[model samples]
Target: MRRREFLKGCASLSACSLLFPSFVFAYSGQPLKRYKRAHLVWEDGRPVKAKEIKPEEEYLFFYPFRATPCLLVNTQQKLKGAKLRLEDGKEYIWKGGIGPGRSIVAFVAICTHQLSYPTRERTLISYHPPGKKSSLLERDRVIQCCAHMSAFDPAKGGKVIEGPAKDPLPAVILSEENGKIYAEAVLGRDLFEEFFDVYRRELRKEYGSSKKAKEEVNRCVTTPLRKYTKEVIRC
Candidate 1:
């Protein structure tokens, strides 16, 4: 089936549909968290200007919580608004990208399949820009998790297009002002609890404690994924 048709069919299926068993179901309601507004800044603390972001580059930043990472991208093309559906069949409209050219977007970096995320040592998941070959059969731009081969369409609110992941990556809603971008909130099912549970030992070793790891942030530094991690393991 064509990609568009497959996505449409997936979206229209009921919770009781055959595809339900394959979905990694999360809590029912769409959870929305309005975090303390955090400015996306550089290491020197200068605000990250939206217009200066290079197209198709993957930037990483931590927000809402100190331990949780998010991916920022500029696809360089105006994106269509996408209707995103959660595993339990809940739906919400992602209002396309923000900033100049309406091409900038961001999402929580943790994979819904198993919560695998980018770490300082290595990243199991990362953005594969258009024309970039990935282990996944699809060659289009996607946020891919090599751990399980789940691929998410960055242009479509991080919708899962392949592999086992069922929920769209939770979006980090952004707002731009005075040419700078800020993360305002996260919209989608709550996955932080599960992520924390699975990574508690690592989080404690890096953050001192799980509580500290979850602390709200007022400033976030944006760095290129290469600068953010020591290695990128592409499958």
Candidate 2:
């Protein structure tokens, strides 16, 4: 079956309740959050122009919170909007990619499975463009986590196409004005509280305090995934 059809079937299946018991009937009702608009800037603090972003390249930035990382991508295709279902059973429409060709998209980098994220030292989760081989059999464009081999399809609202991730990656809602991109909000269930609890010491070391780490970001520096993380572990 085609990928789109498969996703549609997934959306309609009652069996999903069994496959994802943690998400079944656990409707929190709240599925989205409007964050302070954050400009995507370069390391020098200059706004990142949408046109300059290379196709299939992955960029990393912080959004909504200082400690939370997001992945930006230019998929080089006009993507289709998707219906994203949250753990709480709430659903929302992801209006698809933005910018020229409707190719630009972004998603929270923390893995939905275990919250593995990109860091200055290493990244267990990273994007693999088409034709690039990873530990997984999938060679298509995917954001994969080596920690547990969870793979999300960036072109499909970060849908989990493989492995243990039961929920979709939270998408970063993006807008463009005068060729520059801005992150306006996040859509889907966020694991911020669990993330904080699990990584408290690391957060404190990086941002001085958990409170500081959770501070809303106004402007975020966008860097290539390679430059942002010293090591990229693909599995």
Candidate 3:
């Protein structure tokens, strides 16, 4: 009876280990600092008069309409809004919020899973591969990547929930000057590129050499061996 009980306990533990393998190598979430807006177009490819926008209205920019960059002014008092883009020489529609009063939220238009751009369909876009759903609605509440069905909370700065996404979508910053709102920056900080450098050092201390032990041995032995052979031939 004692042996049977021990075997059952081991089986249960093994099952639990297989069920939660994700916890073994979870990704960390660290906050990046917010940055000011830069590189925005207003009228005729000119800098936006940021302070000119009013609280109750949302300004829109349409790219490549005729002469490349066109400004579409919509002062709708509702929360829903639309903007068109031609970034990377491709056409994409961005659907999000006009907010209650001068509030703005922005997210990357690409699907995090496969980079398939989702088109707006009454605030929701559905994916075909495995059939998933995501959306952007009313004041940047959430930007959903439909390919993997990952929902990101923009107010919380693009944190991910549900689906297969392990990283948040890159965020765009906004600023106002002369009552007009303009995009400031993407992901707030340029330091995001250095994330891997910080993580690799931490991993080395905790998990040992990320480089193979065999590779390190091969490098050290080959260099000394070649030098010793040269010395012997000279003698």
Candidate 4:
């Protein structure tokens, strides 16, 4: 009787649709088109004139549209943002779209899990992959989303240190002139909206028409690799 009951329970479990992996997302191979240099604007659309944040702190701003939120942070070293093949036989830190130097950094705040954005406070705890020892090459800090517990290393070009998330959060390339910072363009795939690519195609033709401007916008990037196991790349 117990064996028969166990077989019936197994059949019931097989009929369940709810599961951990609702779906898996892959990289879109299209050339990045969104994000052109523009005046820094506040959430209310007023032009910003000066610095509003201090070191190790972040200030949130919205531009291009309300649905997109960007983050500007002050980090110690901008060296680990993204590893890019900028020169002969060597990869350089691509600013991951943010400007060079450790003074300030900017990136889109959209989380990779379900495309939900994490809060501004430094609330995520540090993490290490199972059975793997920590190293200096790994990121020192991680920004976590409580929704799914995925963590992104802000210093390492917003790479996903822990997951269900398979991609890094897209970056908002920034430029600083005199004493003010501006949102230039976005890097990487959109986390939540599938229609963003369509919108970028039209926006690109309008803003990034010039070849020189297009090249300038294209150089900085972070390439996230696909790994089905825990031995994932850190930078």
- State the TM-score for model 4: 0.51
Off by over 4 Å in 1: 1-31
Per-prediction TM-score to the true structure, in the order listed: 0.84, 0.84, 0.34, 0.51
Task: Order the candidates by TM-score, highest first.
Answer: 1, 2, 4, 3
TM-score of 3: 0.34
Q: In order, how many clashes per candidate?
A: 0, 1, 15, 1
Residues 1-235, candidate 2, lDDT per residue (tens digit)? 5434544678555665444332212222336677887899999978999887887578999989999999998887789778777666777676677886667899999999989999899999998875676656547578899898898888889888887988899988887877778887787877888888999999999999999999999898999999988999987
Q: Candidate 3 residues 1-235, lDDT tens each?
A: 3434544676576774453232121211212233322334433544544343333332222111110111112122343323222223322222332334323544443334444332211212221111112223222334455444566444444445444654544444344445454443344222222332444454345346434211211000101111222221100
- Per-residue lDDT tens digits for candidate 1, residues 170-234, read 88878787887888778776798899999999999999999999999999999999898999988
Off by over 4 Å in 3: 1-102, 119-140, 188-235
Candidate 4: which stretches are off by over 4 Å? Answer: 1-31, 41-52, 84-93, 96-100, 118-140, 195-235
Model 4: ten consecutive residues of lowest lDDT:
19-28
Residue 217's lDDT within candidate 3 is: 15
lDDT of each: 0.82, 0.82, 0.33, 0.46
> Worst ten-residue run, lDDT, model 1?
20-29
- Candidate whose TM-score is highest: 1
lDDT of 1: 0.82
